[model samples]
Target: MKHSNGAQLFLRNDPAKTAPLSTKKPLTIGKASTNLLCMPQTDGVADHHAVVRWSVGHGWLICDWGSQEGTFLEGQRIRNCRPISDGDEIQLGKVGPVLVFRLAPASSQPTPEPAVKSSAGGNLEFAGQLIPMNQIKFVQLLSRPRYPASFSWWALLSLGALVVLPWPPAFWTLELVVLAGWIVLGSRKEHVLLVTLLDGMAYRHSFANKVTALGHRNGIRKAIGQPSSA
Candidate 1:
């Protein structure tokens, strides 16, 4: 969707109170002053809650940063970064303040071409594989949390070294660093684009980045003349 003033988030109850979103950086939604969509007085809002940002192939996406109460998109708790559309309702918590996503008026909407390419005749080329468009049943985005096996081995080795190392205070800093790295790695995830065929066989392509994955999904939908479903 094309909007003259980008996108805006208005309070569900009080539409007058609105927060304009920026395409440059991820908009932070929280009770802190640093957040672009600050809800200081709102109940259940955390300091560093959720974030909304424009992605490359995914358009707009909202993600919860391990918030206490959690963030909900259209009544579903947002586990991973979820793509959002116009008129979508986002609640900070189960009973927290609600914000409605809006795309401001514009003269013309963007018409993006499908990423699909003609490999052989009318067959579609996706993820380096060629398949007929007629065989496509549906396309969906899937996510799974994954921590690198190497990281676990390195973490265990580090902890073991810390146990036997001298100079307790000096090595304590390194231990803390390792712990932080482990936490970050544990939260890492892998995104996949699963294209199911009419024959019940599915083709899965993994993407390290969600934006690229969403782009492929959007392209497939356009190629098949199907509506976008996030």
Candidate 2:
């Protein structure tokens, strides 16, 4: 695919073999072609089954190349060409091999600065909260902890309190409080990082950091087509 941004195709069933679809040429997928980028070993796959192409304006596209069984995307059979987005599943031939697609940010586009905007004296709007940037002790991106919504420390403390408390009513109340907290603050999307800001008052805010510091560093390298620093 001729994508300005890099694209990746991963085998959904067998995630070991991942193909980088960052080249300008269209990636050919088939059963027995030396020129093919992905050659699945499943039955019903033709020699030239399908082609995944990309362009700057149109984005990524998957086109069926007159295969016998046909190409299916997310269970529906594609007529000829279909536009695909990140996390879209592409099945070459009917029930042959499922592949997941992911498109990175285009290297041509400029990286935006952190979404901090000045409002008052040394204060800025960060994650919908107006707080003094200077008061921020640190900022970091945290992946969703295994527990539902509460922070790890909060969970541990609450659990310990429940264990030590002798009153049965108090234990149940604490459990209900934890459950309510999870219900109120739990995120719906998986794999999204939470941007946390710790301030002088020991208060923390968990907000979405679309462009994290680490992301900024890596994005700068990707935008310039430079090798990432170790």
Pick the TM-score winner.
1
Highest lDDT against the true fold, candidate: 1
Taken over the whole model, the C-alpha lDDT of each candidate is: 0.78, 0.62
Among all windows of 10 consecutive residues in model 2, the one with the lowest summed lDDT is: 188-197
lDDT (Cα, tens digit) per residue for candidate 1, span 158-194: 8786777777886787777777877787778899999
- Single out the weakest 10-residue window by summed lDDT for candidate 1: 112-121
State the local distance difference test value for candidate 1.
0.78
152-171 in candidate 2: lDDT tens per residue?
64678677977798798988
Task: Return the clash pairs for model 2, or none.
Answer: none
Distance from true location, Cα of 121 in model 2, Å: 52
Residue 173, candidate 2: how far off, in angstroms?
79
